[model samples]
Target: MSSTIDESAYVEASNGQACLAFKDEKQEARFELGVSMMVYKWDALSIAVENGWGGPESAEKRDWVTAVIVDLFKSEKIVDVTLIEETLLYAMADEFDTNVEDDSALPIAAGIVEIYKQCDAQDFSTVEKLYLEWTEKQKNKEGKRIVQVEEDPLNPDASESEEEEEDVEFEIEDSMAVDEMTENNTEPVVDEDGFELVQKKGRRRNN
Candidate 1:
């Protein structure tokens, strides 16, 4: 569902917070903090799930979730950090499938606040480390998938030949790469004003 911030939404500078009035797809008026909008919790959760957060170890899951939270906040265009701790508390509870009462949310909120404080202090190692770890995990997962595909039973015999063909195709495509070529390095060529030019060896040369 789509939600748009109302024109009347205003920010409170003292607390670095904004109370946004939003109308959802159903045209129902609801309020959320600017941090919630910045986090885009729904989208972040989907991305985390797709990246195998649910299958990782508890510590790994927590790290990935926190990284995503921080990344969301960093990616947003909003100036102030608002409702970040609250949003993260809710997101973590949802990720862990736990019931987080208002009282229980305090600790989670405190942790997020600490991270935010660290960020404001210009020390971003916490977020950076977690993001790099998560990225490595994704790369490893992709590598494993590729290996599995190459080892598939039905294609076992053809795998080697298929790989060779792929290598050849890759080489040909690489040779055709034009991004590094300058106009002066290539021969002068002209396009037909009203006629199609014959393509030979995947190259258009003047007839």
Candidate 2:
């Protein structure tokens, strides 16, 4: 969309200090405001109060909530909050005074969904969307992305490597060495009869 500023509506201030309103009409501020329209119809703090974990403390919580949302979409190139929160179209409660009801118990989760519905494309980008999705998953226990395990190849059991061949060769050599040791081991035994104990029984009698 083009800016609503008329080309002739801007002029230098006295002594060229700054630009002055070329037209003395009330058109400039409105034009500027029109150029940059309100992305969301409702106030952010109100949304935070209704949907955010903190309710009456929303004034304090707004900055943090906006920060979380900013972080969520900061990484994205574009975000479609309408698409994300389309399911919760009817969940948006009317924008009420922050001081009205302390414990109104706005279906906090559903309220969050509705607040998300109010988000516009400019408010958040794709990166922020993914981050918010990640955060929500973390909070809801379903936020984590599933790390898909790579499937093994169909021929996984087939050995086509030189390492396997070398392993087989080593196994055969070890078997041969064990077999040779078993075959060649002939333990010798000395018989008691062959090397008899000395018989000096009658020697003392003879002496």
Compose the digit string of candidate 2's lDDT tens values, residues 1-207: 112322222111345433322132223222212111221222333343334324333333332332333333333333333322321222222222333233222222223322232232223232234334534543554212222233345645655563354344111111111122356593322123221111111211111
Error of 2 at 117 (Å): 19
Local error of candidate 2 at residue 105 (angstroms): 18
Off by over 4 Å in 1: 1-56, 79-82, 114-207
TM-score of 1: 0.28
Question: How does each model score on TM-score?
Answer: 0.28, 0.19
Best by TM-score: 1
Worst 10 residues of 1 by lDDT: 170-179
Stretches of model 2 off by over 4 angstroms after superposition = 1-56, 83-207
The digit string of per-residue lDDT tens for model 1 on 47-164 reads 4333443444332344344444444444443323235445555555666554444443333333344444444444545444543554454455432111112234555466677756
Residue 1, candidate 2: alpha-carbon lDDT: 17
What 10-residue stretch in candidate 2 is worst by lDDT?
Answer: 196-205
Error in Å for residue 163 of model 2: 84
**How many Å off is the CA of 114 in candidate 2?**
19
